[model samples]
Target: TKPKSRSLCMANPSAYNYTTDIFTAAALRWLETGRTASKPFFLYLSYTVPHAGGWGSWPRAPEDGNPVPSDLQYAAELSWPEVERDHAASVSYLDARIGEILRELERLELSSNTV
Candidate 1:
């Protein structure tokens, strides 16, 4: 058998959007206008974060290539190792995106019914 590829989920190749933003936007779109008004919907939204180690561009050092939008906020944590800071930033970025989805659910008055 052939060995599997190392890249599980590569980052977005575009400069303007990160992978998280793309997935989050899709979830938000569904919550906002893509769902059927007569039926309940199930959204299986997944995110890639703290694991930006997936293959992509070299905007920063090889260890810092995750491309998370919140990376800059963690850049100030000088006491921690660079890789750790990058991981934290990725997680924080994911958290904010999830918050957006949750807020959208609330806005649509579906939070009480959603799991």
Candidate 2:
């Protein structure tokens, strides 16, 4: 197996910002100010979640490699184990990011033209 790469920002506060948040913000920013309406624009966005070791699992305890941001989106799942709750939270976070992007598209009048 190939060695997993680690994030250089693992120790930074921004490291906990989460991949979905970062990508969604970038997508929104581009849609708002970085694009030209005179020509077609192509944006490719991919999110990492419901996957192993987010940010290379930096937010997790040293012994736990599967990590999610320390967010409470699933904190109400008291019956679930912490790891499972974290996973569920991450998935929900991804869904929210997608919704944000879609909303931005609609706001920008790009949904019908976008694929």
Candidate 3:
């Protein structure tokens, strides 16, 4: 079945920022609602980083200076020198957010009983 929310930002190759935003939000929600006494909660927090069309794809004209027209920014046409750097940064941002959630779990003493 198709997803109910087209909210999967990872599908947008140019929007790693969007993917990170979604991951963090979901992690927060999972932490809030996933505590139970009898069963271990399983969270599947999938991230769409280093996906297609992200900063990992190509460097567009700067949004503030000498910006190219929107119509001219093609992923197939541009060569970005820092694609790996951009991907790494995106991954790091999401990792940090996950760390925050794990820290909260530890603080609440949920790791021992619930994991």
Please provide TM-scores, in order, for all candidate models, with all chains considered together. Answer: 0.60, 0.58, 0.51
Q: CA lDDT of 92 in candidate 1? A: 84
Q: Could you tell me the TM-score of candidate 2?
A: 0.58
Candidate 2: which stretches are off by over 4 Å? Answer: 1-16, 34-40, 53-78
Error of 1 at 43 (Å): 0.8
Compared with the true structure, model 3 gives a TM-score of 0.51
Backbone clash numbers for all candidates listed = 0, 0, 4
Which pairs in model 2 have colliding backbones? none
Two-way TM-score contest, 1 vs 3, winner: 1
lDDT of 2: 0.64
Candidate 1 least-lDDT 10 residues: 1-10
lDDT of 1 by residue, 1-115 (tens): 2223323343433432577887887788778885544567778986766565833443343344554444556644334455555776787888999899888887777776653
Candidate 2, residue 20: lDDT: 67
Candidate 2 lDDT, tens digit per residue, 1-115? 2223335443333444566667778789889985554557677987867675533333333233444337746534334455655776788889988899889877777776653
Candidate that scores best on TM-score: 1
